[model samples]
Target: MGFKKHLSSLKSYEAGKPIELVIRDYGIRQKDIIKLASNENPLGTSKKVIKAIKKEAKNSYRYPDDSMFELKKSLAKKYKVDSKNIIIGQGSDQIIELLVQATCGSEDKILTSSLTFAMYEIYASHNQAKVLKTKDGVHNADQFIEIYQKSKPNLVFLCIPNNPLGDCLDRSEVYRILDSISSDTIVALDCAYGEFAAYKDKNKEIKPKEIIKKYKNCIYLGTFSKLYGLGGLRIGYGIADSNFIEMLSKLRAPFNITNLSLKAAIIALEDSTFLKNSLKNNFKEMKVYEDFAKSKNIDFIESYTNFITFMLPKSIDSSSLCEYLLKQGVIIRDLKSYGINAIRITIGLREQNKTTIKLIDKYLKR
Candidate 1:
């Protein structure tokens, strides 16, 4: 059996360690484990969304509405865009794959931040396209503009409030980079954590309606996983001009979303009370992490998202620290794979935060 030569160089995305696996590895009780590795909503799922999912469970035997009528309508109203401007995917990830498939071929290039989402590079490789990154660890408009002019990549991905790093560029800065690119180059603004950023600082908000209305080459990607407590549901959407949406829609498979996911996402959109309380708790707990970092003289990024990335000192290895915590049944993301000596932890519940902090303090003292 022959596989593409490039497939050998590709690596699978290493997700956050699951609790069952942790239990098997460390012999820890399930209730004792604290998982802050994935940037999932600490508040858990909304009651309204749960009710909708329960109601829709009976209909799971039937195929989903491929048109995605209800979910799109809800998203459209929220973003103030037309239903024609939207396309649904399993997650923003599938949409990313669709964009690469629709626009790229061998030797074509995709430009993005040096230390952003891993999927951007993985998907580009699937199409045998080259991936270019900024010299900086995070997104720099100046660096992006320079690279865009030099590489003229077929697609550019901007991960706002970037994952594993937690830094963001303002709308004006993002637009400056966009302004420099030619109309033919497609740009993807991935704001999966946008709701958290917007709640913290208005300037960080990347409005989908404003983006779609302004640039035909641009598309806005959002997900229900981060803030809506729907990572398990795998429902996400993309917003672009009607023409672009139509083009991507052509590549999407029918019934890509499940019945329960579609129903949950629609109700999740309307569950503003859950969203508000989650945001409040996120920032409140985020401060605890910040204070802990400062007390320990550990440097960390000021996060707009629900998680914070702590840049470990030269004395502390990221993998070593993560392993120590994992053995104790506490899980968090280690950025060693991203070539950084850092750990990205989701802002968990108050008790979870305190437990993790005390454990970190113990690690440092040891």
Candidate 2:
């Protein structure tokens, strides 16, 4: 038997290893390992969400609501959007795949910045769409406008506070891309880390909701994986024009989300206290990272998200440095996969952050 040529050319996504797997591989105790690879919320899921999950656990025999009506309603209320404009997915990654499946064809091109989220490229390839990589590690709106004018891509993926780099484009830049693109082209804004982005000057406000409302061709993708600490649950959603939402609904599998996950998400959404605390802690830890990098005279990009990406000194090999950190029970992301000589480390608990810095200092000194 033979597969399609496109399928053969597709590269599988390499996710971060589980703590248990890392422990087994290194023959180290689980207690000693600290994983900061995936940019997860170090505070973990809210207590209310935990309780909701536990309460719903006994009802595992029942299938989830295919419409996800309750969850959709909660989101609609939170974002001030209509329920008809929302569609749920297993995660933001799944939403990206569905967008590609619905809109893109084998010869269609998807435009994205270089070194953006890897999943966008993977999903585009899976759907047989040609991907056009931008020149810079950062996604500049002007570059996107130029590319769109020349190539006229069917779809575009923009990661605000982009992965691997942790930098976000200003609202004016995003608006320029949105305004310049042809109406026939679709724009997908991946705001998975939106909640972590602080008020930077006057232009960096969270604007995806407003953008979705303004542009019929625009879709806003969000995930509970980062802010709500629900990565294990694999729950995320998209907000778009009602017509696009309807199309996505038809393409989505029934019961795509689990009952427990729905319940947890509902509770998580209502946990204002937890959300506040998580954001506060994230800012505090991020400042610590910033101060540490400054003190060490290290070059790092200022992050608007939970993760920080810093260049490795010319004397040190990034992969080897990562390995050294791993041996010391500190796990962080190596950006070699993204064609960069940098590493991304997630902001964790205060004690964990201190320990990670200490370990990295020890390794760098030697």
TM-score of each: 0.99, 0.97
Name model 2 segments beyond 4 Å from true. 198-202
After the best TM-score superposition of candidate 1, give how far the Cα of residue 349 lies from its true spot, in angstroms: 0.4
Off by over 4 Å in 1: none
- TM-score attained by model 2: 0.97
* Cα lDDT, all candidates: 0.93, 0.86
For candidate 2, write residues 217-272 as lDDT tens digits: 99988999998999999999999999988877888888899999899889899999
Once model 1 is optimally superposed onto the true structure by TM-score, how far is the C-alpha of residue 138 displaced, in angstroms?
Answer: 1.4
* Local accuracy of candidate 1 as per-residue lDDT tens digits, 199-306: 999999999989988899999999999999999999899999999998899999988999999999999989999999999999999999999899889999989888
Q: Which ten residues in a row have the lowest lDDT in candidate 2?
A: 198-207
- Model 2 alpha-carbon miss at residue 77, Å: 0.6
